[model samples]
Target: MSDTFFAYLVTLAYGDKETPTLAQVVFLSENEAEDTRTVARALLQNAKQTAPEKTRFDWSTLKVHGSQSLSDDELMGLVAAAAQGQVGVGRVSTLKLS
Candidate 1:
């Protein structure tokens, strides 16, 4: 059996003030989570290049939410059930095997 793990999708934003104006998060595979973070950082850098001269990019934040664990078979079953309208979005959750 494959070892189970947790992955989180984090959104980072920049702003001049102490407070952040935007935030979002999601669950993904471990590799996907890292890829998402890398992409966000690159996008932020690109924005700074074209942003106004005085734009202050001072604050960055990351938030994680939602947790569940499912094996490959469990995930497939969930997908199949959704196709048949036997389950809804509320039933979707992470799956981890000990």
Candidate 2:
């Protein structure tokens, strides 16, 4: 049987604002996803140092929009889109299967 993977859709806010300005999708085990979220939160503490001044990403706004199980093919497409830099600043976990 193939291993099951969970996809987490995360959005990062640049400042103390409530709205998110950036989005990223991460695929991993449930536990790993939780751990990654923690790390993301820690990174937010240094957002100013990490992101350029022109890019307004409020680290305090980081959040997990949602999560779901992804089939192998769907996961592959996400990987492909990430490789091609086509994800942009939007949701990627919901891409339809072709």
Candidate 3:
């Protein structure tokens, strides 16, 4: 079976719905889907602490499995949070598993 990857831009906050600081998670082509999703969530959670509440930190055009996962509401929130320098996304990960 094929694998998937998820790039995260986590917020430097405690809230699950909070903006991200600057993090990403990549799903390996050789990893299980369930495991990859878990890794993505965790990475986002970890990146939250680095966000400052403003900056162009919102994740955009990020190649991954679930851009749709970032719903319209969520995107709006991310934009607002990023405008306030809440977080920043930088240096995406290159997850590879074979």
Candidate 4:
């Protein structure tokens, strides 16, 4: 999908970090999408690199917005509380656009 066709805004915070990292994934805009994906992957890797030997962080699919133009605060909420877990993507949202 094109980044313009599908854009994602993700706000993530480390478990202990005071501030968070915000990334925008744009499928149409390969560059931006690649950038965000890279950051996400890097962050995931960083967390894994620091994780204790017997622990693991589950991979999850998070949605912070729809095709239109709005942000998913719920997804951000989950990310804010990011534990050694993943987001429940099964909850397909039909949320109203803002």
Per-model TM-score versus the true fold: 0.25, 0.28, 0.29, 0.22
RMSD of model 2 against the true structure: 13.9
lDDT of each: 0.34, 0.36, 0.38, 0.34
* Model 4 C-alpha lDDT versus the unseen true structure: 0.34
Q: What is the lDDT ranking, best to worst?
A: 3, 2, 1, 4
Write candidate 4's Cα lDDT for 12-54 as tens digits.
Answer: 4333244333322211222333343444553444344653332
1-98, model 1: which lDDT tens digit per residue? 33433444334332323653233334333332235434343334433453333222222222212233445675444334424433212111333424
Off by more than 4 A, model 1: 1-66, 90-98
Candidate 2 residue spans exceeding 4 A from truth:
1-9, 12-65, 89-98
Ranking by TM-score: 3, 2, 1, 4
Candidates 2 and 4 compared by lDDT, better number: 2
Model 1: how far residue 92 lies from native, Å: 12
TM-score of candidate 4 on Cα atoms, chains taken together: 0.22
Q: Which residue pairs overlap in candidate 2's backbone?
A: 13-57, 13-58, 14-57, 14-58, 15-58
* Candidate 3 local distance difference test against the native: 0.38
